[model samples]
Target: MEQAEAQAELRRRALDYHAQSPAGKLSVIPSKPCKSQDDLSLAYTPGVAAPVREIAADPEKAYDYTGKGNLVAVVSNGTAVLGLGNVGTLAGKPVMEGKALLFKHFADINAFDIEVQARDAEHLIDVVAAIAPGFGGINLEDIAAPMCFQVEEALQKMLDIPVFHDDQHGTAVIVAAALQNALELQGKVFKGVKVAIVGAGAAGLAIAKMLRALGVEAVYLSDVHGVLHAGRSDLTHWHQPFATAPAHWTLMDMLADADAVIGVSVRGAIPEAALSGLAAKPVIFALANPDPEIDPVAVKRLRPDAIMATGRSDMPNQVNNVLGFPFLFRGALDCRASQINQEMLLAAVDALARLAREPVPEEVQQAYGFSGTDGLSFGPEYFIPKPLDPRLRQWVAGAVSAAARKSGVSRL
Candidate 1:
């Protein structure tokens, strides 16, 4: 009864929080002053024409005259919202607005949340490509898997600006970074560890690709049906590369002897029995939100030696995508990158790993409501840096920008 009342209170507070404002979470405010007649003229009609003409002559001048360099379009089709599943495009506006808020709050990037009524991947691709010129970068969000892969790929090829799917690569980057640090603490090497991922959706597939880039050869992926083995006829192209050869391998078989397990699937997706087969000092990231694959408390009881992370803020080592997307786009937009490539993503991963090892700043400690850096050190409990760490803006973003320049992807 108490739990139910608590949940009801939370629901009421959330609704009130969103409803109390200007009806929604976002607003368009003029960046320039327009109090006087001359200011108005410069802001719009006559004086604006000068810069307009320059922009017309050279499209690159849009960055000089307008807010184009710092603008990002947070595009979503509402096909797959992590916890909510397929909430319609209109229904997904709040989540996108929250993402925009994160961009502004964390990295000072201006983001416009665009909810597109796209019928499929092709439609979303077309809509985003059409509006690509207005944004410095496109942040693909909440679109379902299989389709998300298609949409992101098409937009990346069709548009010159950075087109990133946050559900995929953003989650992948943070997970990779956290896992890298976790592995280092556990005395495991990236190339030597065997990882079993329990979801073959956008996050899972992307995590697999990211880990592969970091030099892990033994990656096993599974969907709802079972482990994605070579004999699975229903496997998509995205799932095939990560498939194991043995046809009859189950989730238990995949978990057996694995050094790490990452769950991007729904709650209760992983059975408690599966933990019995894991290698010693296992690294487990139960990233299913609201509820994890298995309870962290349960994991603690069952395997005291395990290092665990979850998507919940209440948990230590929360594998939050907030740590990745804001600074990533900040760097890409600052550099005017042609696209967000593998090198940039790896740079973010590397930056995050190194940042975790450094001492937590006093500002960061206070931001997370911590009194001091007692538990927030470079250890199993805090392998990933807190999302509120201000250093992330400079460290991760700068590394990404430098890599973009080095990789010859930067237009700046």
Candidate 2:
């Protein structure tokens, strides 16, 4: 009864918070002053025409004359939103707006949340491509798997500005960073460790690709049909790359000898029996949102030697995507990157891992309500840098911008 009441209170508070005056989490304000008559004329009629003409003559002038360079369109079709599956466009606005809010707060990037009524991947690509000129980058959010893969790939090929599906790559970057630190802390070699990933959706597949690209050779992925293998006829091209040769393996079989098991699936996806199969001092990243695949407490009981991470903010080593998107876009926007590529992603992963090993700043400790000696340090419990860390802009964003420039992807 108490639990039910607590949930009810939370629901009420959330609704009320969103419902409060202004009615939404975001707003548009004039970056340039528009108070006086001269300012109004310059902002609207006469002066606007000058920059408009300049942009018309040379499209690249849009960056110099307007906010286009720092603007990102957070586009979504609402096929997948948070832990709520297939919430539709209208229902997904809050999540998109929250993303916009985060983008603004974290990296000072101007984001406009755009929820489109896309029928399919092609429709989404068309819609985003049509509006691509206005934004320095396009951030695809909350779209479901298979379709998301298509939409992101198509849009990236079609548009020059960075087109990123944050659900896929953002999650992948943070997961890689966390795993890097976790592996090192446990004295496990990156390429030597075996990983079992539950959930072959957007996040799961992206993580698998990233880990492989980072040199982890043995990566096993599982979906609703059990482990992905060459024997599975239901597998698509997206799933085929990560599938093993052939096996009658269950989720447990994958975990049996895994040095790390990452879960991006729903709650209770990791069975209690699987915990016993993990190698000594294993890394467990059960990152299903709202709830994890296995309860952290349960994992602790099963294997006291295990280093566990979750999607929950209250937990240690939280694999949050906020640690990725803002800084990534910040770097991309700053550099005028043509696209977000593997080199940039790898740079972000390295930067985050490097930041985690550095000494925690006092302001960062204070942001999370910690003080003095009650601060974080580099260890199993603090492997991933806190999302509130101030150094992220300098470290991660700087690294990404440099990588973009080095890879010859920077338009500037």
Candidate 3:
């Protein structure tokens, strides 16, 4: 098949898959009987008043009387979908459903994706904020940056329930984990490390913020135009935070002598020149999907001591959000988190890092179709744990719940 034909065929199959299962995921079921008059009264009428009154008397009792405690709404405007860019509201549904599926499968949490048909960021945030009272937590996904920052900040400040953007923080959590492991393997530290982050978009910005949160001594970022630096007249509001000594820096300048390079930009931005002069045994997470900024093979060939990770499944050390999200919300819902704070994000990152450091089971290797010969090492090719590692759910969830409790955000 020609390239266009193959692409068309794949799209056709994806549509077929969705059409085969109409109405998307999540269907409400009547747990109480409606077959008899007495059942009707108890389930929907006068008899329901007792529990309703009790719950009204004590807000905390809502967890026992309703699904309020175990449910999450994955809210998004669909301004960003995959790497497809802004495809609008209707186009993002399947991805939302996929999020719902992962939530159920990975953590047994009841999640529904709420797609706001609003044409602007304000409308989406308003809709989510108005409905926030009904859910235990909100998981924001696939919205673009700058605007996403505004929406998350607004919702977090106003809503009592936890609000999170999986793209920003989910990617951050895994990268943090991989970096922690990679650093340990290299006998290096996070502070005093020169970090180059390619891509000024949501994931890139979030990863930078998280690295700063985790105590990175120095940081740099590059957009399509080049590096984000101090007083760069062309820099956007989001890019200003990572600005360095100069007004602007080229991609190669940013990468030279860097201890770590995080590629959240498009494919092939970092040619071999940019990869040169990286610190010995450099940690590289080429996170661009489908194709990373640097070819992994070329990277390893050029720098034998370098550690390599990407967002691709075929590569070792895949830092997929599948490593998180499912279990991250599980903890928030279980704890009845009133808001997703920096505490929750940090907790997930630490838990994920530690979990990635654990020994991989033989079955886990078998599931990945590996020969089971690779020792459990948290380094270049082994920085992240396999998706099938069973302990992920408990480890991530427990830490989030603990953070929620300690942070005074947990109702449980």
Candidate 4:
């Protein structure tokens, strides 16, 4: 089929798939039996009052007496919905539901997707803070850039439970892991490589910070206004840390001679001609969804030695956030973590990077229809684990939980 026809068919099938269900992607089911009057008594009213009273007396008892320990609220204001951008709360419901689905399917965690129509950043923060008592963790989703930073920072400080903006931290964790393996494959060192990041939005900024934390020597961040330089009047406070050192350079100039180029920007933002200027065997992660900043095929044609990745599932080394969030939250919730700290994130990254180097299971290979023995091996094309790999839950969750304990964030 033609690309347009294929997309149309996918749209039709997606609608049918959602409509065929009980009208949506998710539903709440009782964890315990509620078939008899005896069961009902224990599940509610007089019998349930015992646990409620215990929780009221000692607030920490809620983790034991109620479902709060394993429940996450996937909250969103919908100011940025993937590539669609600022589609509002209601329109962003499907994506949030999909996130909830991943949480359940991947890590056996329960999630409630909450779409809040808040007036502003403060209102969103206030609303989330008010309803946060029932959840073990909060996964903030789809909020815009500067506001997203503000909302996450405010919530993390106010709430004792783990408050993570998945768009920022999730992407950061996966990208860091992939970059680790990709650098090794190309015989490059993190501390020596010059990295250029396009689109200094939530994901881009977070990735830059995480890379720097992982010991990358130099990171150049560029938004639509070109390279972020010191004293730029338009730069937000969050963008200030990433501003280049008193130099004037276009995005193309920054890309030139860099070891890697990561894009979280819009489609076609990075010019194809600029690929030639990159260091030999450059690592390119054109991570814009549905479409990338530079076409992978064109990149390969121009620089076949380049290591390439995208946000699409069909691509090799796809940096999907699904690889991080579910398991990260699982570990955090299991350990009764107070916050998702940097140590936890670094542990998650290391776990993922290590997992990719191991041999792929036959089951995972079969699921993705890999026929050859070499298909799953770690290399330039296979720098990250596939999203459906069941081992992610065990590896990432365990590492994160251990890190939480070591970092003094775990209540368990």
Candidate 5:
């Protein structure tokens, strides 16, 4: 679709969507038989007592006795939705509802959207922490950057169940998977890659830390005001640990000889001039949603040998968080993880990247209706599996669950 046409079409769809009103994506339905008096008695009064008694005797059995095990909650304050930014708690409903549907569809996990109107992070954290016991896991979604970091940290520190901010780790996982694949494809070593992370928000910071963990030699993280140097006195408390040395190498210097650049920043953060000095076979992920920091086409034009990826599904080599969130949550919830730590996140990345390395299959290709599935050449674009691919849930879940077990954080 052309730009003008796409905009008009989007507006039209938005109007139609609002017209249709509530009753949004899904509704809760009873799973047990409820046809007669015997059924009602069994499902509610007499039979329910048996499961309740068992669960009371052994608390862990609540997972088996109730839907608590496989069910997660997508909790948000609507303080930030996409780039729309601060749309209010109630306005964030549609996005949360959509996420719940994706969780159910991708992982056989039941997710409910909880939108609360809290005065601040402390208020929201207290409320969510109080309610956290009911959920097996919590997905903190589409909340703004620094605030998101604080909220997730507070909740994870306070709660027993896994609390994940998909914007941070989900995006980080997929980017890591794609970066691994891209580097492999180009015969590049991750160890020596001078990486530049543009956007010191949740996703960017997470990516930076993960890359550092994976051995990227050194990475210079930058936000709008420029490089996050050790001497940057204006750094927030949330961004402090990342304040490292060698402050002389600014973003300009860092990007001058960088091998990989991950842009989660605002539009057009990387000027064409900066692209000129990047190392050959540059693995650049301009992963800003809706619109990437630089158009992949533009990046290709400026740096012909560069490998490009984005957050948009319409484009080839899309580096989307959808590739990781459902499966990661599946594994974490199943393992009864106390929190989604670095180990579990890295494991998911490894599995996802490994899956990308295999030859694409016929059925998987058929699923996309794109003809790459029958042991076809699956490359960069296919690195991360689509959320609806039906296979990654178990694959990713197994990796995370195993990691959680290994990390000694698994209740299972």
Candidate 6:
């Protein structure tokens, strides 16, 4: 098939797949039997009243009495639906449902995708806060930036449960992990390297902060205008911390001789000419979905020694958020964590990085259709573990739970 035909076919199949299954992707099934009057009594009404009274008295007993311990609310306003922006709440339902599916499939966690029709940031925050008592954690998804930051911060302050904006921290955790392995493969040290992060939105800002916490020497951030420099009038409060020194530096200037270039921006944002100026054996993570900041193939052609990754599944070393959020929330919910903090995120990053260095299992190799007798292992093409690697639930969740406990955030 031609490229356009292939794309058209994919669109048709995706819509059919979603439409074929009970009209949508998710449905609530009772965990307890409701087949008989005896079971019904225990599941609701008189017997259920006992647990309700206990929870009313103690509050903490709700975790034991209800699904509150295992349930996550995947809340969003539908302002930013992947590459398609501001498609409205109803249009964004499918993506949110997909997230819920991932939660159940990947980590055995139950999720209710809540698409809130709030008027503004504060309204969305209020809505999430009001409904937060029913969930163990809140996975904020697809809300636009600035507002996303506001909503997350407000919700985190008001609610005791883990409130995570996956667009920001989820992408950050996976990227940090992959970068750790990528740098190691190139014999580069994090503390000595200068990093350039294109697209200073939620993901870019979060990644820069995470890398700084991991002891990277300096991180230069850029948006549509160019490199974020001090005194730029367009800089929001969130962008101020990432602002570089007052210099007339373009995105190309920031990329010049940089040890690593992380792209969370739109397609073709990084020109071909810029790739040639990168440091020897540079790590390039062109992580924009569907289309990346720079084409991976073009990057390889321009600089043969460069280590490359994209958000596309077909590409090698894909920095996917699915690798982080499900298991991260699983650990947070398991330990009754109050918040998913930076410490927990870093723990997840560490687990992912370590897991990449270990010998890959046969199941993982088969999942990705790798037929090599040597088995799947860490290299330029395989810096991070595949999303289907079953071990992620164990390693990431364990590490996150441990970090939560150590950070004094875990109620367990």
Best by lDDT: 4
Error of 2 at 365 (Å): 1.5
Which ten residues in a row are the worst by lDDT in model 3?
371-380
lDDT of 6 by residue, 237-284 (tens): 999988974478877789899999999989998889988789999999
lDDT of 2: 0.92
| TM per prediction | 0.98, 0.98, 0.92, 0.98, 0.93, 0.98
Model 2: per-residue Cα lDDT over 1-412, one tens digit each: 9988987998999999999998989999988998899999999998789999998999999999989899999999998999999999999999999999999999999999999999878888899999999999999999998999999999888889999999899999999999998988899878889999999999999999999999999999999988999888898899998998358787778889899999999999989988888899999999987789999999889899999899999898889999999999999988999999999999999999999999999998888778887688998789999999989999999999999999999987
RMSD of each: 1.1, 1.1, 2.4, 1.0, 2.3, 1.0
* Higher-ranked by lDDT: 1 or 6: 6
Per-model CA lDDT versus the true structure: 0.91, 0.92, 0.82, 0.93, 0.82, 0.92
Off by over 4 Å in 6: none
Question: Candidate 4 versus the native: TM-score?
Answer: 0.98
Better of 5 and 6 by TM-score: 6
lDDT (10s digit) by residue, model 5, range 79-152 = 77876779998889988998998888778789899998988888888888988777899999878867788888
Task: Give the lowest summed-lDDT range of ten residues in model 6.
Answer: 244-253
Q: Which portions of model 3 show Cα errors greater than 4 Å?
A: 1-13, 23-26, 29-39, 234-237, 371-377
lDDT of 1: 0.91
**Clash count of each predicted structure:** 0, 0, 1, 0, 5, 0
Return the TM-score for candidate 3, rounded to 2 decimals: 0.92
Residue 193 of model 6, lDDT score: 97
